[model samples]
Structure formats: structure tokens, C-alpha cells
Target: MTDRLKDFIENNADGFNDLEPSQDSWNKIAARIGHSEKVRNKKLRYISIVSAACIAGIAAFIIFFGKPQNQTDNFAEIPEVLEAEAYYTSQINMKKEQVYQMAGNFPELKNEMEVDLAELDTIMVELKKDLNDNVSNSEVVEAMIQNYRMKLMILEEIKSFLETKTDDQKNTTSYEL
Candidate 1:
């Protein structure tokens, strides 16, 4: 059987060679394969582009609109700043309380003090944001301390003014008596 098959192939080899496919047929097959490949490549390119755009959009969203990290964690690392902030905060609260008590008869003065303190509070908030954005900005921390000092100074001055006014009233009453 093997000898017969070999003999048949030898006899028909020339005929098989003579019946080769046309060049046009080869070109058509090549063109079809090439076109399919091009379509596949285009689909792949579009998928990759869309995927990249989605990744970039997600990254931007997380950067711009994500929940803010706790700022106290950053401040915790700076013990001196924390101590100063606590100290100044306590002092400021005490002084503000004293000023409020003394300025009961002076609503205008209280309002003025609130306006000034509010401005300082706004500045302090901006400084805190700056500090959060840049974890350890010494200048911003110093500015925050200075802002506290200014608030304390304003309260002290108002308290002194009220004290003098009270003393003057007392002296006038004594002289009248």
C-alpha cells in the first residue's frame, strides 16, 4: 500500500505543480486576512484608549473630590505646634469669656470684637488648610499662632477698656457721695 501511494504521488507530482493556484487568488486571500487584522487592531486600539480615559477620570475624581484626610493626624506629629495650639486656644477662650462678661453693657463693642475675631478665624482656617496641604509648613503654623495671639490681644484690650470705664464710674459715684 505504501509503495502504491508513493508511485501515485510520483506520477501526479508534475500535474499537481501545473495546477497551482492563481496569483490573484493568493492576493485576494492575503487582502482578506490583512483587512481582518486591521479591524482587530482598530478595535484593540479603541478599547485601550477608552480604558486609559476611564483610569484618568477615576484618578482625577479621587484627587479632587475624595474625602479629606484628617488634619489632626498631621498635627499630631508636631508636638510643639500641638502644645502651642492647645495653650493659646485655652488662653484665648478664657480671655474671650472675660471680655464677654465685662462688655455686657456694650453691645456695639461685643459686635466689633466678634467681627474682628471672625476675620482672624477665617485667616486661621486658611492657614490650617495650607498646613494640611503641605504637612509641615512652619510658616503657616507660626501664622496660626500669631493669629491666636492677635485674638487674645484684642480681647485683653477690650477688657482693659471696660475696666477703666468701670473705675471711672466708681470714682464719680464716690465723689458724689
Candidate 2:
């Protein structure tokens, strides 16, 4: 079919080559296709902004309103778990401060290595909810603990990378004039 169409175009080239649709026809075509570039861009920007806002709103909702009731009966190892949680939270906070300082020294590195801690935190919260419903479930408790450990590990790795990077710069004694 494409070959037939090509032959037809070749045979009828003289008839169509000089044909010009008028300005009115062009305007009608543009109207039918909604061909204004600015209009398309504006719609795109609007959609992007709205989509971002929706994501932020949903995240906020999960963080703030998704927690189950705080009944002590829901967790078996409450004291030990809470203590571990506190320790990991403190470690994460310390690393965040370090990341803040590192960001000043290495903006691109900080941006590239950063993780969405909020999402992890949200999953941690959701796991707590699951733990609440299943007090005897050791797996859920282990998962929650694992999440905390994973977060601390990530933070420590970033800190170690930044520290080594700075140390490397300090150890390098060469300068080109």
C-alpha cells in the first residue's frame, strides 16, 4: 500500500506541488489540531504543578493521619523496641546534620546521594501499624527494626563517603600555578 501511494504521488506531483491552502484554511487546520505552542506549554506546566501538589498532599496525609491507635498491648517488646527506635532516631538526626554541613562543601554530591528519608519513614510508620494489629508477630517487629537499621546504615555510608572525600582533598599536597 505504501508503494502504491508513492507511485500515485510521483505520478500526480505536478498537480499537487503548486497547491497552496489559503490562510483561512491554515487557521482552520490549526484550530482543529489546537496547534498553539504557548497554549500547549501552559497546559503542560499546569498539569506538572498540579501533579506535584497531589503527590505532596498524599504523602503528608499518610505521614500525619495514617497511624493506628497507640495501645501498649499491641507490641510485645515495647521497651526494647522503643529504646532501639530512640537510638536509631538520634543517629539519623546526627547524620542529617552532617549531611547539611556536607551539602555546603559538596552541593552536587549531596544532591546526588540524598535519599527520600520521608518515604522510608512513612513505610516505618505503616509497619508499626501492622505490628499493632499483630502483637505476637516477630517478623513485623524485625522488619521495623530492619528499616531503622537500613536508614542508619545509609546515613553512615554517606557520612563516611563525605569524610573520605574531604580527607582525600586534604591529603593531596599538589597545586598547579
Best by lDDT: 1
C-alpha TM-scores of all predictions: 0.56, 0.51
* Per-candidate clashes, comma-separated: 0, 0
Segments in model 1 whose C-alpha atoms lie over 4 Å from true places: 1-76
Clashes of 1: 0
Cand. 2 Cα-lDDT: 0.61
RMSD of 1: 35.7
Alpha-carbon shift of residue 40 in model 2 (angstroms): 40
Q: How far off is residue 169 in model 1, in Å?
A: 1.6
In the range 6-86, model 2's lDDT, one tens digit per residue, is 899899999878977787996677667875544443443444344334444544454455555545565745798788778
CA shift of 126, model 2, Å = 1.2
